[model samples]
Target: MLSVHEITELSEEFETKTPQEIIQWAADTFWPEIAMSSSFQTQSMPLLHMVTSLNRSIPVFFIDTGYHFWETLMFREKIASEWKINVIDLYRDHRWDVFAKQNIRSLPLEDPNLCCYLHKVQPMQKALKDIKAWISGIRRDQTSVRAHAKILELQENGLLKINPLLNWKKSDVQEYMEEYNLPAHPLYEKGYKSVGCAPCTVAIGVNDDERAGRWAGRGKVECGLHTDMFSKKDIADVQNEFHLDITKVK
Candidate 1:
């Protein structure tokens, strides 16, 4: 593994490399210890294609929050099957089942941050615990939080978060999709450019930002996967942002 300073220097050089080149390096460096996550959305096609093409043995983590659209689930199955990619489904810790079940209908609307933490963030954090590297598809132009992200970020836990597509824009995704003949998410044609949990996602006009439909009007642009929240291990650390009472969780 590269030291922090070496990783920072290499990350800088990676800014000038293509997404595929960066992905190849990650695979070469981490191999079986490395994996990638995807929402199986339209914009995720390019990175998914690149990573799997470079190495099919790398596991692809998909957080099955149990709140996804049926279409999204089916689309994930189709792509994984057709491409022969190793898709791994991740779920929230079974410990939260009772609480999550009790507020299933209202969680997403009332406290999206906590809802995401329980379903997406926590599951992903647990899934990557044993993994050394995680490849994400976030682009700088996608959101304000992501705009300042580095190509390679070393987490406090010593995990390497690689953003191969950090510098790519929506145009780059489209061009790659067209060139490789990748299929779009089923909801894409119906104005759903960005897809997440069915409750949090909506369709938007072509001129709208690529992520405008995600957590729209909710003052939430991220689900904590790319933010500081991913590193947090205690619920108390984020209690203020949640509506649920953590004291009663047990």
Candidate 2:
């Protein structure tokens, strides 16, 4: 129950603390009420290893976007099994099934934002509704939108969003993963620097930004989970961003 002002103050102080220290504080402060989300990508290894190492019981939310690459799903299963992690699978609500099925092929290319909203954002919103805090594996150097994010963000719904790896960079992730002998996503070496749903993701050159492969050439960067889209509770609030006419979605 931290006040907004208090959370802001603490977030500033956290910039000087190690990610592990920040994670430990979050675990101590909110154990059962807290959870973390992972996309099961190569870059996500460090945060996943650190959190589960500290406490194996912390729930991990994995959005099972039905459009994921088969390798991503297999890698996720391998990691969860080997680490004995408490991984929870999240899926889009049944209400969107008919609409989703109808536009299965065109949805991603026609309106990726809406597709992500239905698959990734909405499922995570529903999964996190009962949680007090959410730990995410985003780093500042990954994207321009994430560069300005704080270590702790208090959502409009009062959920505390914690980003322990906010200050970490691509090199830091690589170094930590190597040091800990963490497993990489199967497609990591295949030039899939940043993996997402099949249609939106592509392989990129080695020197490119780690996330350059995600939603390339789509004029879309984020999947809406880390954006203002997450704050909107209803479809009406985000209908303007969609290429699909969602007014008749019922």
lDDT of each: 0.91, 0.90
Model 1, 1-250: lDDT tens digits are: 6898999899999999999899989988998899999999999999999999988889999999999999999999999999999999999877678888988999899988888998888888888889999999999999889999999999888899999999998999999999999999999999999999999999999899988999999899999899975567866665655545766664
lDDT of 1 at 112: 87
lDDT of 2 by residue, 26-78 (tens): 99999889999999999999999999999999999999989999999999999
Model 1, TM vs. native? 0.96
- Provide the RMSD of all predictions against the true structure, rounded to 1 decimal: 1.5, 1.5
Candidate 2: pairs in clash: none
